[model samples]
Target: MTARPPSPRAVAGRILRHPENLTESEQFQLKNVPTHYPELDALIRHVRSFAAMLTGRQGERLPDWLAAVRQEDGPPGLHTLAAGIGRDRDAVIAGLTLPWNSGIVEGHINRLKMLKRQAFGRAGFALLRKRVLLAR
Candidate 1:
C-alpha cells in the first residue's frame, strides 16, 4: 500500500520549525517535499531565508531578498508579501534591525481587550478600570 501523505498543517509546521528540532521522520518528510512539489522548494528556501534574516537582525539584506522574490517565479503569496514590505520598507527594516519593541505594551493592550470582552454588558467602566489596574 502507498504511504499516506503528510497533512498540510503538519508540513507547514515542519517547514516553520528549525531544522535541528525536527525528528527523523519529519526530516524524511521534509526531504521529500521538493520531489512532491517542486515549487514549494523555492517557497521553503525563501521562507527560511526570511526567517534567518528576522532572527539574525539582518535587515540590510531585505532589499536584495525582496528583489530576488520579485524576480523569481516564486509563489504568488511571496510576491504579495514583498509588495507589502516594500510599502513599509523603512519601518520593516527598523523593526527587524532594532532591539526596541512594543511587545509589553501590546501584551497589556491584548489583556485589556480580552478583559473587556469577558466583562461586556456585565460591568461598568469603574469596575473595568479597577480590574485593569489590579490585573496581574
Candidate 2:
C-alpha cells in the first residue's frame, strides 16, 4: 500500500487498482508498459536503471534539496512521502533512501507470468479462468 495513514482495506484497493499510485521510488521502478514500447532499447535502459536504483545497486542518493520539496503534495516527489512519514527531512536527502512497491502487484505479475509460461500461449479463455480461480 501507499503507507499513508488511511485504512488498510482502502489502501489495498488503491494499490490493486492503480499500482501507479505509489511512492516516488516505486514510480521510478515501475514499468509503464503502455507508454514505453517498441523502442525496446530505451525501455530496457529505463527499466534497468530504475531496478538498479530500487535494488540499491546504483548508489545514487536522494538529494538534500528534496527536504524543501517534501512539504509539497502535488506528486510523490521525495519530499511528499518523507513529510507524510515525518522522516527527518535530511536523513533520506543524503543517504540513498531505498523505497519499494509493496510487492502485492509483483506477486500478481509473477503469478500471471507463471500462468503464461505454463499455458504456452495456447490456453482457452474458459480454461484460463478456471485455472486462475482454482489457483486462488
Candidate 3:
C-alpha cells in the first residue's frame, strides 16, 4: 500500500474549514498555519481583526481602522465595502464606535411620517405640526 501525503496548504485549509475532522494536536497546528504561509494567515487575520474592530464600540479607534480598510490589502470585498463606507466615512465611524445612536431621532421621524400619511390631504401642515408636538 502507498499513501500520498497531503500538502500543507490543503491540510491547513481542511483544518481551517473543518476543525472537527481532525484530532486535538491537528487542530492545534491549524492555529499555527501562519508559519507555513504568512500571507494567507495575514489575510485571515485582517478579516477577523476588521470584524472585531466593527463589533467594538470605541469611536476613537475608527480613524485607524478605516485607514486599514483603505489600505491595498486584505479581501477585495473589504475594499468595495470600504469604498461604500467612504461615501459616509464620518457617519460610518460614528456608527461603529459611538455608544449613542439616533434612535430618538428615528422615532420622531417615524412619528412625523405616520402623521403626514394620516393627514394626507385631510389636514394641513399646521395641523400636522401641532399633532407632532402634542403626540406622546
Candidate 4:
C-alpha cells in the first residue's frame, strides 16, 4: 500500500515558524501552499506592525497603516477596521503620540466590569453605578 502524502499544513506551518526543520521536498512544497495561510500570515504581519507602532510611539504612521489596511485584499473585517480607524483617526493618533495613556480609565472600566459581574442579578443599576463610582 502507498503512504498517504504529508498534509500541506505541516509543511507550511514548519516553513513559516521553523524553516530549518524542514527537508528539501517539504520546503519545496511550501511554494505550493502560500495561499493556504495567506490571510493568517497577513494578520500576523499587520498585528506586529500595529504593536510596533504603539510600542515605538510612532503615531505618524497611523495614516500609512490605515492606507495599507484599506488596500490589502484581506477579509472584510480589515475594511471595517480601516473605517473605524478613519472615524477615530484623531483620537487614535493622540493616544499613539501623547505620553498620556488611557490605562487608568481602562483599569477603572475593567474593575467596573468585574464588579458588575459579581453584583449581577443581586443588585439594581443604582447599586452597580454606586459601587463602580465608589470603589477604589
The residue-by-residue lDDT of candidate 4 on 1-136, one tens digit each, is 9445458567436544545666787765654454565774565456657777887999999999988888788667767887998999999999989999779899878888899999979999999889877888
Best by TM-score: 1
> Could you give me the TM-score of model 2 versus the true structure?
0.29
What is the Å distance of residue 22 in model 2 from its true position?
35
- Pairs of residues at least 3 apart in sequence or in different chains that clash in candidate 4: none
State the weakest 10-residue window (summed lDDT) of model 3. Answer: 11-20
Off by over 4 Å in 4: 1-35, 112-136
After superposing candidate 2 on the true structure, give the runs of residues whose Cα lies further than 4 Å from its correct spot.
Answer: 1-61, 64-100
Preferred candidate (TM-score higher): 1 or 2: 1
User: 102-131, model 2: which lDDT tens digit per residue?
Assistant: 479889879977876798768887887888
Q: How many angstroms is residue 120 displaced in model 1 relative to the true structure, after the best TM-score fit?
A: 2.0
Q: Name model 1 segments beyond 4 Å from true.
A: none
C-alpha lDDT (0 to 100) for residue 124 of candidate 4:
96
lDDT score of residue 115 within candidate 1: 92
Q: What's the CA error at residue 129 for candidate 3, in Å?
A: 4.2
Ranking by TM-score: 1, 4, 3, 2
Per-residue error at 30 for model 2, in Å? 34
How accurate locally, in lDDT, is each candidate? Answer: 0.93, 0.47, 0.68, 0.76
